[model samples]
Target: MLKVLNAGNETLYNNVSFNIKGQEIYANSLILICAAPYFEEIFVESSTNFNQTYNDIEPDSFRVFLRWLYGESLSQAMQNYEKEENRDIFFQICKDLLLASSKFNISTIKELIEYKLVTYIHDDLVYDNLEKVIELANEYELDDLFKYCEGLKDVIKDEADEPENSNIRVTKNNSRPSIINNLKLRFFKFRFFLKTRTEPGHKFKVIN
Candidate 1:
């Protein structure tokens, strides 16, 4: 038998146990759908289903959905999923998560989106995702993301204008001393040179 509890401060699953497919499982919420052998048990604060259609049915999709419902961070949602060799699903999940996060008022998830998009600025593929990133940043008033995009724009323009085989090097040039100091040093050097050049026969007394 499956037992469920509503939102409350008490720990519902403490020492309470059940059997799923002959394996002992203890959780807060258990949804045992008819004709389904596996049990879906999850511990969450709140959950709701939207009428939106999903193209790909990946775990990340469900994770993002949960994040949107609970206002959880992107990092927390990603932690719930197991790591996969191909991250295509993960990337799409991140994009969807950002959209959902922005739709709601999830500040931490929005921050994660900004961090990821800003890091992509140094990549050549950033141009492909530039529009979406810029739109999100602008909508959320992300100053750092906007600045990073501006810097990437300048870099792309510079690279386009520069010729191949042209090595651009940056060097620091030291400037001379002030004109007044230079004149003072020159006068002092001239006086020293004149005194040293003159012999004892033509003795000259130095005056300040």
Candidate 2:
């Protein structure tokens, strides 16, 4: 329907066109009216303006929703395009879709973003953005990702505080003592090592 509608199929009079964030798109009222009650009211009150552009959501993210309405799956494609480049932008748009979905009470879109966020816990989800993502999870009541993020605090801590090296050295002196006696005397010493490297502008304390 989207492909046909986008191709300017004037025969489909049952559908309505929209300029969402300056990008033109449209969908069948029968399909979107039920999913979004706001559309239903717009049609009911005959208040929809075909020329007016709706700026409620971002253009690209709104395109995602329009595609989803046309029977295309969103979450699977997002997971398949997993890349490190522009991670923040992708997640930020996810947040936008989440907000837009929430506004219309579209649980499917909301759930799609939740699943993506849960997957992010294993990827670039780090301490820098942890608080923001956790806030979003809490806002949406995404218990799964919330608990996952909580568990990662410990995991990230372990990653940061891990010992760089731990070695044990052993020495034997036959004149001083037999091998067995030397073993009993505790000649082996354990050493703990840690890396001193830290990123610039990161908080570091020095002792005099």
**TM-score, per-candidate, Cα-based:** 0.41, 0.64
Worst 10 residues of 1 by lDDT: 33-42
Question: Which pairs of residues clash in candidate 2, taking residues 3 or more apart in a chain or in different chains?
Answer: none
What's model 2's overall lDDT? 0.55
**Which residues of candidate 2, in runs, are more than 4 Å off?**
8-15, 47-53, 76-81, 165-208
- Listing every candidate in turn, what is its Cα RMSD in Å to the true structure after a full C-alpha superposition? 25.7, 18.1
Clashes of 1: 0
After TM-score superposition, the amount by which residue 83's alpha carbon in candidate 2 deviates from its true location, in angstroms, is: 3.2
Give, for candidate 2, the lowest lDDT window spanning 10 residues.
Answer: 187-196
What lDDT does the true structure give each of the candidates?
0.41, 0.55
State the local distance difference test value for candidate 1: 0.41
Which residue ranges in model 1 land beyond 4 Å of their true spot?
A: 1-59, 64-88, 121-126, 165-208
lDDT of 2 by residue, 3-89 (tens): 564554355643577687777666666666655666666666675543336677776676666666555566532543456665766
Q: After superposition, how far is residue 85 of candidate 1 from its true place, in Å?
A: 7.9
